[model samples]
Target: MTLTIWIDDWQIQCCGESFAPGDVVSWKLLEVDPEDYADVVGSERAREIDCREEHHGQGEGQDPTPVEVVSVTEVHCRYGVPPGAADTMNCPVPGTTVLVPVDEADGWAKARPDVRFAGYLVTARQVRGGDSDDVSAAELPRSPS
Candidate 1:
């Protein structure tokens, strides 16, 4: 399934690896609380993925989840607004309260290279453990030698 994962700037600065589009990655993700991230994710989007229980990583633990990087976008939170009413934009702006991305790439040459932005937007597929073709093959009936 295609999923958008949020990675915070602090999390990146603390412990993050550089990545780009088309890169497959593994990360530990947690469910995104719609009410908590409504301002950044928008109400509609939050609800859309609510049932699916969208996941995100806080740059903790060794990544074990698999996902693919599709695109990277910087989330700019405007200034001089309510605590959680700041407008979010994909493009750069002046005096942003906070900056983050749906996807993350350390040392990106384009747009604010000096400044580290937010997180990453990744496409993740749901794969149940011990359910791969290899596992099935091993379970096949054995033929007498």
Candidate 2:
């Protein structure tokens, strides 16, 4: 059976309505002012939502947590994306923003064994702290003055 994880933090919302033992809330309330992620939620995030009539995805290898699109860049044009991922996402071209699995980009090639193209190394963004987004990842050499 496909297990559904109760995703807490990064959900960006909470719920006021009470439900029976396993009722799907569908709509949860969040503390964040709606404006904070208005653009994301309205566009990309909305599409990210699964639209099957079942409401719950029972498919193989489905992820339960919510992930935010931090930014989209060519897999090679941008560093930090893991190795072994295909040059397609890494090559200089625009593509759909990918939602990463909770464990980070460790399973790209292993999980998608069927796909030969090197894929992207997706990471969980909503859970990370400050400066992880803004700082450059480059390492500078130390110099003696």
Candidate 3:
């Protein structure tokens, strides 16, 4: 499943530069690392040392989960677009811009070198799509022949 990543934080920069904050980007789910009990206990001990320490959170304290990113997708934002734009995954407008997979961007960039890339740095406003529609393939599994 793909998750939305806000590029408000600087990560990657093109042309020997990085993107600025308030820029919303997309990052696909890659891998997740579960927090260990030992680490949690250690953190708890450290907190104990500082009596004034305040922990604000829920669900398994002192354990931070790690997630690995597969790829970063820059959003091609359009001007005059409403604050509440269509839901990219399920846009209902006939002329509305839609969402696309990031894997397809590499091919598109290579094919059209002169073409501007996505994001605020580029001029594109709509994300191009990847190959394959919403058709399931798990129906036909391979056999151990």
lDDT of 3 by residue, 72-133 (tens): 34333222423476743422122222223353222122222222223211111112243222
For model 2, the local distance difference test gives: 0.25
- 2 versus 3: better lDDT goes to: 2
Each model's lDDT = 0.45, 0.25, 0.24
Give the residue spans of candidate 2 off by over 4 A: 1-63, 76-117, 127-145
- The per-candidate count of clashes, in order, stands at 10, 10, 1
Against the true structure, candidate 1 reaches a TM-score of 0.51
Give the lDDT of residue 131 in candidate 3.
26
Looking at candidate 1, what is the lDDT of residue 32?
Answer: 51
Off by more than 4 A, model 3: 1-3, 8-11, 14-66, 81-96, 104-145
Please report the TM-score between candidate 3 and the true structure: 0.22
RMSD of each: 12.1, 18.0, 20.6
TM-score, every prediction:
0.51, 0.17, 0.22
Residue-by-residue lDDT tens digits, candidate 2, 1-145: 1111122211212222222222322321112222222222234343332221112223223332232433221112112333576553432222322333332222122322222222222212222232222211121111112
Most accurate candidate by TM-score: 1
